[model samples]
Target chain A: MKNVQRIWTQGVALFGLSIIVGIAYNTTRIVSVPWIAQPIQLVNEMDRILKPVYEPSIKNISIDIAKQLVDKNIPFIDARDDEYYHEGHIPHAHSSGDLIKLTEYLDIAVGLFNPFVVYCSDDDCGSSEELAYQLQSEGFMNIYVFKGGWKEWNASGLPIEITSNE
Target chain B: MNKYIQLGIRLIVGGLFIYASIDKIVDPSEFAKQINNYHIIPFGLENAIALILPWLELFTGIGLIMGIYLEGSTIWIFLLLISFIALMGQAILRGYNIECGCGLKEGQMIGLAKIFENVIMLIALYWVIIQPKKYFIIFPKTELEE
Candidate 1:
């Protein structure tokens, strides 16, 4: 019994010592500032980790296909929410959301599909990519991602179609 | 079986912990994703956990390797393992598709395989605690002359 107790005491001491040392190491912290130091480090690291392979750029079509009111010829797909779409969209741009539910409007869009263009809020936004990928999976070809998207179009001071679905 | 074998295990496990912590400290956002996916903790605590966990791993690893505090280090490792087992169990229950975060980037989803691995390691750790002669000791060994 005494031997067992002695062993137990030793175990307790070892456990306590380990925690103290462990705590000591963790308490050491150095100020590594962002932008000045870490950002450069991360960019260099990201360059290595992000794959080199490239997917073909999705094409951008610049034409007004609705009743020929505007003199542009391209298929525009809107990748924004219903709220944004009802507020305004590039004329003749189809919503991917309604397409998912209806599935019938897909043919009308496909019928006019030459230089298909997908656009969303802006370049940094991912909705356009998601819609394009979904469309591609559904066998629609000639897809393009409008890097400029809505912000660019509005910023360019081009004509826009606005509605009050609200 | 012997002191050398125990030391070898300690070195390997400890070294891996230190190596794992380095990457996590460098890229915390990714580590935060791993912790969040487990869903054992809420979103509010995720960032704090992401910041603190790597440090815990680092200290535990360094302490074990240094062997200056074998008993403390071994127990900490044991407790860490227990916490890990619980976390993995929770992850598995919640249907998370994440690596076990065992410092391996190729961390596979927590599954029966991982549970088995943890169980085996826990047993080995228990043995180390019970039989201190098998592990590296901070105390200098008295030389025996025949």
Candidate 2:
């Protein structure tokens, strides 16, 4: 019983010591992380500087809006992995799995000013929002995140294309 | 022979911990994303975990190697190993093919292999706990004398 108590005390002491050192050291770092995670804000503050008119660059769209965008022939970006993307995705959607490859294709095929939609596996998946944020950072002005992504699209009986491995 | 073997295990485990903490401490944002991939920790607490965990690993590793707080360090490492095993096991079972977030190796995906590796380390930690002889300890002279 005494040994258990002693061990617990010592373990806690070490933990407390670590917290002190960790927070102190993080303060000294040039790129220190916030102690608490800030919520994901789709609005990029840089937009104010880049576009004085200041509309949100990234917008969360419903399946209806996403469908409308598809009908209009706007480009779509799949934020899921290559395997998942290859399995089945919205027709004409580009894969954002490899940012470099995606950006390269975007450079030649699409303009930064044109609107694009990003989506992932499902509503619960965060990759769509994450990709939207990445696009926003990359100075893509008009971005839409289809929160109800592939799952919703497929469930709705929307048009999809499966890429062959050949 | 037994004494030298135990000392060697101590140093190896300690060294491993120190090595693991470095990359995590450097790129905490990436580490936070890795932790979030597990889908276990909620309320954005992965950020705090990412911040503190590497430091704990570093201190635990240093304590083990220096023999500064042998019992505490071993206990901490044991607890950490168990949590890691549990987290990895759940991630594998759920079919979330994500990065391991181990900080030891980059881009190492979570799988049975990682669990096996951790299990081996857990066994080593257990060995250190049961061993009667402790050598070259710099602090808490009483334990060193024993």
Candidate 3:
């Protein structure tokens, strides 16, 4: 038991020393990049590991609001892959999830005045949130994520586009 | 067994840890994301763990290899391995099919295989912990001669 306690105490001391050294080592990097110039600044949850700054929060929208937006004829963006997009998508929603496709669709996206309601395959799918953050970084304001995405919409028997891939 | 066998285990374990900390120390953001996938910590302390854990591994690995701090370091090694076994076990039970985030960058999914890998490492570390004679250490004459 004494040896065990000694080991534990030593481990704690070693860990604390490592943290101090690690922070100093990482901070005194060869090149110091400005936080604002970074593609995305770390904030909130990312602050724990990331330095310089924490990531800004992204706005999330619920399915009900997403449905209302759909009814209002606001442009919808599908944040899923080409295969998934072609499988089935929300009616009238444009596919701009992948980088290549989004670049191709950028002309239309930049010209649009209404906010983009982006969604992925399902609730657990992070693509929608990720795409929203990407758009925000690109100076596109008022992006909303349909947290309950294609899965919820399809299950609810709402408007959907089934493009046969097979 | 041979004292050389213990030396071999020490080197292997220490080298493995040093090898493991490299990728994590480089890309902690991605590592934090991987930890969050485990769905264990609620407060998003994964980042804190990510920032600090690799350095701990580095020092412990070095200590093991050099045999400067044999008992405490090996104890830490075993403790870390046990925790890894538990983490992998929990991930398997919870059905997390995400990348194992093992040293090789998503080497495999967390499953029985990953758990078994850590188990084997734990066995090796335990051997280091209780070895009657550590062969290659330079400091702490009392620990070495005893």
Candidate 4:
């Protein structure tokens, strides 16, 4: 019993020390994160763009929203690697794997005014978000990130097309 | 032979923990995102955990290696390994298909292999706990008894 108490005490002390050191070291870092994360607010209006302020233009949307966009024939961008895209992808989705190449394709095939959805492997994959951000920086607007991505879409038995190996 | 074995366990576990902490300490935000991928932590508490966890790993690892607060470090190591196994197991069961956030390897997905690794470490820790004679301890357990 006494040994347990002593171990517990030491554990607490170690935790406290870690907290102190962590906070102090974080303060010294130039790219320190907030102690508490703030919720991401969706920006919908173009009026906010006029203020010369930069907010993330890409908004995360659920599978339902993605489906609605697909119904309306909004363009879909597959952000996975070329091989995965070749294996299978959402119907009529465009992908080149290379961001610059994809951007060029988007410019030639679909104008910037058209709203599009971007997706990767699944909710756990970060490539879709990353691609969306890159697209945003490249002056693309009205972008939506399909967070559920290909895994969810495929599991749901949605329409998908495979590129033929010629 | 027993003393040498104990020392080996300490070095392996301590070195592993310290190595695992470096990447997390360097990129707390990325670590937070990886933790969030598990979808277990609620109310965005992953940030707070991300901030503190690496430091704890570092300190406890140093303590284990140097034989400072040996019992406390071992206990913490046990708890951490259990937590890791549980988290990885749940992620696999739920089909989350996320990165392990282990800090040891980048893009290492959650799967049976990770859980197995943690179980091995847990077994090592058990040996440490049961060993009668602790070797090369800078601060002996007797001091805490007093």
Measured against the true structure, the TM-scores of the candidates, in listed sequence, are 0.47, 0.81, 0.64, 0.76
Query: Interface RMSDs of all predictions?
Result: 10.0, 2.4, 5.8, 2.8
What are the per-residue Cα lDDT tens digits for candidate 4 across B20-113?
9999999898788778767778888889999999999999999998988888898998899999999988878765555688999876878898
For candidate 3, write residues A46-127 as lDDT tens digits: 1221122123434456666677667766678887766878989988788874555674475375432235567887766545
Q: How much is A29 displaced in model 4, in angstroms? A: 2.1
Clashing pairs in 4: none
lDDT per residue as tens, model 1, A1-166: 6544544564566545544643454345353212111110111122222222233323433322221312344456778777787777877677666545523565464432334567787654545655665565555554556656777777767778887774
* Model 4 agreement with the true structure over A22-76: per-residue lDDT tens digits: 9998999998899886644444443332233234455777776677667767779
Ranking by TM-score: 2, 4, 3, 1
Give the candidates in order of lDDT, highest first. Answer: 4, 2, 3, 1
Candidate with the greatest DockQ versus the true structure: 2
Over A1-166, each residue of candidate 2 has an lDDT whose tens digit, in order, gives 7667767877998899889988987899898888777644443233332232224466667787778778877789998878888999999898886677777776566557666788888766656765675666676776777877899999999999999745
Candidate 1 segments exceeding 4 Å error: A1-166, B132-135, B139-146
Chain A, model 2: TM? 0.67
| DockQ, ranked from best to worst | 2, 4, 3, 1
Model 3 achieves a DockQ score of: 0.29
Give the DockQ-based CAPRI class for model 1: incorrect
Judged by lDDT against the true structure, how good is candidate 2?
0.79
Question: Higher-DockQ candidate among 2 and 3?
Answer: 2
> Could you give candidate 2's per-residue lDDT for residues B43-70 as a string of tens digits?
8888899988998999989988888877
